[model samples]
Target: MTTTLAWIDYLIMLIYLAFVLGIGFALKKFMKTSEDFFLSGRSIPAWVAGLAFISANLGAQEVIGMAASGAKYGIATSHFYWLGAIPAMVFVGIFMMPFYYGSRAHSVPEYLRLRFDEKTRGLNAITFAAMTVLSSGISMLAMAKLIVVLHIFDAPFASLGLSSEWIFHASIVLSAVIVLGYVYLGGLTSAIYNEVLQFFLIVAGFLPLVLLGLKNVGGWDGLRHSLPTGFTHAWVGMSQASTNPLGVEVFGLAMGLGFVLSFGYWCTDFLVVQRAMAADSMTSARRTPLIAAIPKMFFPFLVIMPGLIAIALPAVQEAAAQPGKAATATSWPSKGLIPAEAEKDPKTGEMVPKYLRQAGSDEPLLDANGQKQYAYDYNLAIPNMLLHYFPTGMLGLGLTALLASFMSGMAGNITAFNTVGTYDIYKAYINRSGTDRHYIWIGQLATLFGTIVSIAAAYAAAQFNNIMDALQLVFGFVNAPLFATFLLGMFWKRTTGHGAFFGLLSGTAAAAIFQSLTLPAGAGPGIKGGWLANLHTFPSEMAQNFWLAIFAWTTCFLVTIAVSLFTKAREDKDLVGLVYSLTEKPREDHLSWYKRPLALGIVVLIMTAALNLIFY
Candidate 1:
């Protein structure tokens, strides 16, 4: 039987799509030139830019990933949101925002060119473009996978004796096409405006899920009773062997990677930086990230709390009782088993024996090996919870919010790609003589091309084990070193381009080696049996991976600084300007109330200490 979607659900989604397209069409007036298209005519207000920045950054992966982590690691996972991201946002607001805004660079790589040389700028631009495309593709693919699992659309083909896999493939293609169309129409302006709408929808849809889920789980007392000892204890279930491969301690691996990756993402990524750059003035740009930081402080409640509540649900408990059956039903194609036809409910038109359907009050769920499936797949937990808990009409709103996340993220990536392609690549190398109109056309073409490539990449990324883990693994290798280079460049002027380049390369190489050699296959020995392995297996592995990257970055920085001191300096005019600019005093009058860093610092300290205390 085919489940009929409620008209209200369809109407809500249609309205959202229309709203997004309307913004894109309206923003065309601002798109006469490439600058306007890619950077919102460089006149976006601080508040809009800030909202867009948060919206773009909070994609489906983040929403889903945080919930997943909460299920896997408990409240400790909150550290990533609070201690890791918030401080980085504040740092960018106070320090990095001014530098980027003052430079008036269209992209981060353009800043690199002004700070270093053309080669560095070109390399950074290419790397940023490549990473952005890959990440966006993976994110889109994951979103599609989630929708498929939720059975968002009718698998009519399945009912017609066709495979549901085709349904999955179609969903991905259709979503990508819709996203690319609007992004090509209007660049950052459309993206930012759409993001504003998405931000509200996501928050509105998510909060109820948390509250309702908690109530269903018997509130705080029931949750505590149902969960294992240490479930509420921030650090109760954490295992170094499972979560961290290098056996690094929590502070060393988690905190270090959090610090490095957060800075790299918030400070260095053009997706976020473009928003700051689009602000009207340096002060506005500076305040944008700071304003964004405040909202971020509350994200753990929205993202992490739901998953924690999910674990206590009676449905999840029933599923846990029948491991073998549950595993067989829900298992993906990777397990080398052909999927049996789904059984349908005659009245509801929903699949009756859907793998993730809630267990009857009397039935018990089983695990893969015919035992109780006590531990859930963290990745599947959130989707399973949502599908079971939400009613049909509310389900439409939830789905729209989820799609909004995907669209906002995709839009952000498209805008960043277009900005770098137009300003950094086309203007810098292909056609220095091109007019603003010419560059705008180039950006549109680039956006279209990027979307196509991202869709393909998304399909390929499906082969990976977990979406969030794949993204983090990629970031660990590529972004960790960039963090080092940016840090050195900002604080240590003596650092040379050779240092920056080599540091990034070394860091990436080290991270790759650690990932390959140290990360165990499935469940392997806790790191090569050594004296260090006994103390803590997981953190040690994580630490090894993180530190290797740090070591590579630091080694590169030192070598470059030492080499540059002995070697002759480049006669680059922009490099000279960068050096001079560092020495100038701040323009005092332009400073707003937030210009003082003390309040931000206090907030950062409180959040950091709270996270640590909770985890400890």
Candidate 2:
């Protein structure tokens, strides 16, 4: 699993890094104002913002998690893209962007403050800031681990008389420096441009891998035969929780993922919304997500193919039956094979993972932790596929793409963190009337603070083997409930600040309570929950997350409506642009039918539905 990169690969990555820094430096002169730094001066074109919107999301969650789930759950992973992303992206660009963009607010939390109470905005701001840092850490962990696993920096480190063990730490430091260097200089504008770069790089880097992988696996038809039952199909076997690899029924998938978690992340998550908010006008803001959704509809093939191919390819000439169970480390074709627990080494009297062939075999199969030998490691599907297929020159491009994917996440999260920290938290609470120049200084400082916090968070991400699982769990807790609040506040003017705030608290509590009481079927009681009691068990972690979101959203929705009835409401004049009923609809009569948000939104939905059926 450890592959050393060549000088050519190193050179390609270096060039990409330099260009990344160059873009930041080039944009530095324009970032004098806080608006320019945090919101891109709202001067970006719709097309650029759209690309940045998608690229901002192509971090560890997209590249690593998508591929991991594809390997683990087959084409069902497409649900994360098609079912989870497209509709919400279209909705945000169409329905939500007007409130966010026209409100003249600095951030999402600021928008909340405009529509609701300060307390509600404060809670969201704090939680969102925390989530961004944690998310940034996850991206950092992916990059550092990739460098360590691939031994990408081994040559350079050794030449500098550094111990190989320092690779992980050094890599983390280097990754932080790269992201911080650009983000500190250009802020949101720099991150957005870099995201556009990452988007292109990811497509360019992964397209070859997908083409070569499918070629090796006998194309689509061959891949179907090579995969296990239901692995090639997305919608089939979804009727029953036990019938599919995803371990959830149709209802759970639709409501939990498609509705709750999907809307929670795409519609409300600041990580994505910040991109649209940076658009030049209401039209561009509305178009940002719609444009992103066009390419998003087909991204599954680019990202998910590697995982399917990774699992389908056999170490020997003949393929074997796909096996169940996940490993904590990088696995290549081994996900299709069963692995036993590590055995004790007779000589050292210490437990260590071992590769066995027969009754008398002694092959050293231990990973870096001496515990990741024979089992399936779903996390490395993308990394493994890249190594398996790419040659020297192409390998550098692939590695750069992978690193860029990670940077998109770190940069996006850090940028969002700085804005929220500076405006939502500091401006609102700490320093009520800071000068614009002072706030810009604070934002740059926040960037440094976020990177340092993310470094700590990256270490925390190592506890989870499945990166996507870790990601969804975070969203389920922070986002799922928040969406309920936003839905009611924007659509129902009767929803009071007290109601929204209390409903949010209750919803978060409900998520925590549900998690503590339920456990996935095969998982032991740990962070996967069931600490309080195993009152209910789920088919899988993904299933649990979806249901958790359902409960959270439901609780918040009901509680907010009920509480609003008992609380005082604000004046209609103040609520004009904030609430949907009071707010005038965005006009697109001057534009052609095809250019209208609704028309494009409907088309996107129709196309997404077709994809689900086609892959079913």
Candidate 3:
């Protein structure tokens, strides 16, 4: 499909860029101290903080990844939201926010230092700092790649006599510059404000696409009738790993994704929690993630439905067939018939799917000789829909929204990196004591360092298969087992610092071992790259992740318990407010019904359960 950007679209995009930069520069007066720069001086309201909480996660990679997974796995991909995210977000808001807020720690790692020892804090800090930078780089890479693939800047670059290669490099650098300008000037406050803006832009940009796509697909009833069997249901085929599109059994989905990965990302991951921590009050902080969860429950419709609609488009089918020339259209479709399977082309001996290819451009992959190549590129799902459905001005707005999401993601990581590096690593270890001005300067420097490193890492991420796979690998390596240490330390008062530290070490090692042993050979460097012998083959990557997390959490839970029994424990008084049992719970009987955390949590759970049943 051919689409061109109009001058009006360029105007809209330019206005957006200026407005974002204006927000960043305007907030510079607020950056008076490290606390203000890092935590917004702990005064952000619950609703704004809640929007930022979700927007921090609404990156370019996440948008593309959600749509890609939706196309590849159907409604089963909603597992990432409903089962994998909502409960964990609720848990963080209701049970974990007390200690996080009451302790007054600048970062999550700092909390570890107060609860455990310097060693536990050090491990988490280094790991988290590294993860943030890497994730930032990935966001940068995804944006650059999208620009190249969608030709978002091609016309302007061509007018300026610039090559595609320059466009690629310029796009990455420009994104970095834009994100750094805001984040460095206003710190976390600027990032949070822009995230709220980005969230609205995303909704405004994509909601139309969903509405149009749904209309084209004949609405909800049409969608159910048009999609493949088992595609619409969330849990009907989850009894076995092989039966479900997610390729994980009910046990694995519940424990691994619903519990381990969900809790790991929401409760412990600083990316989202940083927003919650900046809330004006304990009540607001607790409500931050809860409010974020409300919209999250419905996000799959905006991000994933477009992918489903793309499959039904004639252009997508035509591109997959690669009609005429060296590539002949093999088994072209008839009206009202959606091809569900593929057969090898007799002449070319290539496996051409009868339906839409899952990945890449609607156009078939071209070889060096300009011959059509048969490869499934599911990542092109959303981009294809934009090109096909959206007009010039609307397309520009959608692309601008996409760019905004990328910048928001990058800013989120940069802010997290600066805070963690300054407070957790630099002040705690390098300087011991620094003035408020000195630390704020250090945070600015950290932002610069993070931006440069992320630029480098974005180039590295270009070598990965895709963003979604790269993230899954990171989770298996770090987050799967990391949650175990936090779970024990926060709730189990007897858990020693040594037990917590060693248990974390053992759990991470177990995850690596499980992944390395099961990962197949020649799976590439980042995605399931393994050094040891391949011990087993998993039904899918998600299945492997489920089992890997299960093992990691189980190992850490057992090890922490066993090691704590043998080691010296801290006194209960020292653990007051940090440990759940020792901390006094706030009485909510006097509070309004809707304002109570437990009441809100129960409502969220009930709504989530109802969604699962409806889809099931």
Per-candidate local distance difference test: 0.69, 0.85, 0.83
Task: Compute each candidate's TM-score over C-alphas.
Answer: 0.82, 0.91, 0.90
**For residues 230-257, could you state the per-residue lDDT of candidate 1 as single tens digits?**
5465544344434432234555545466
* Winner by lDDT between candidate 3 and candidate 1: 3
Q: Write the per-residue lDDT of candidate 2 for residues 1-616, one digit (tens) a residue.
A: 3354788998999999999999999999999799999999999999999999988888887888888789878998999989989988888888888899989888999999999989999999998998899888878887887787667888889889999999999888989999999999999999999999999999999999999988888899999999887998998889999899989999999999989888988888888899999999999899999999999989999998788888888752112212222233433234532222345668988544444332234554456696534645567678767777787899899989999999998999999999999999988889988899999999999999999999887776676566646565655676778889999999999999999999998998899899999998756787798989999999888899899999999999999999999999999999988999998898889999887888989999999999988998
Clashes by residue pair, model 2? none
List the candidate 2 regions with Cα displacement exceeding 4 Å: 1-4, 316-374, 460-475
TM-score of 3: 0.90
Model 3, stretches more than 4 Å misplaced? 315-374, 463-475, 519-531
How large an RMSD does model 3 have?
A: 5.4
Would you list the rank order by lDDT, best first? 2, 3, 1
Question: Per the 3 Å backbone cut-off, how many clashing residue pairs does candidate 3 have?
Answer: 5
Worst 10 residues of 3 by lDDT: 318-327
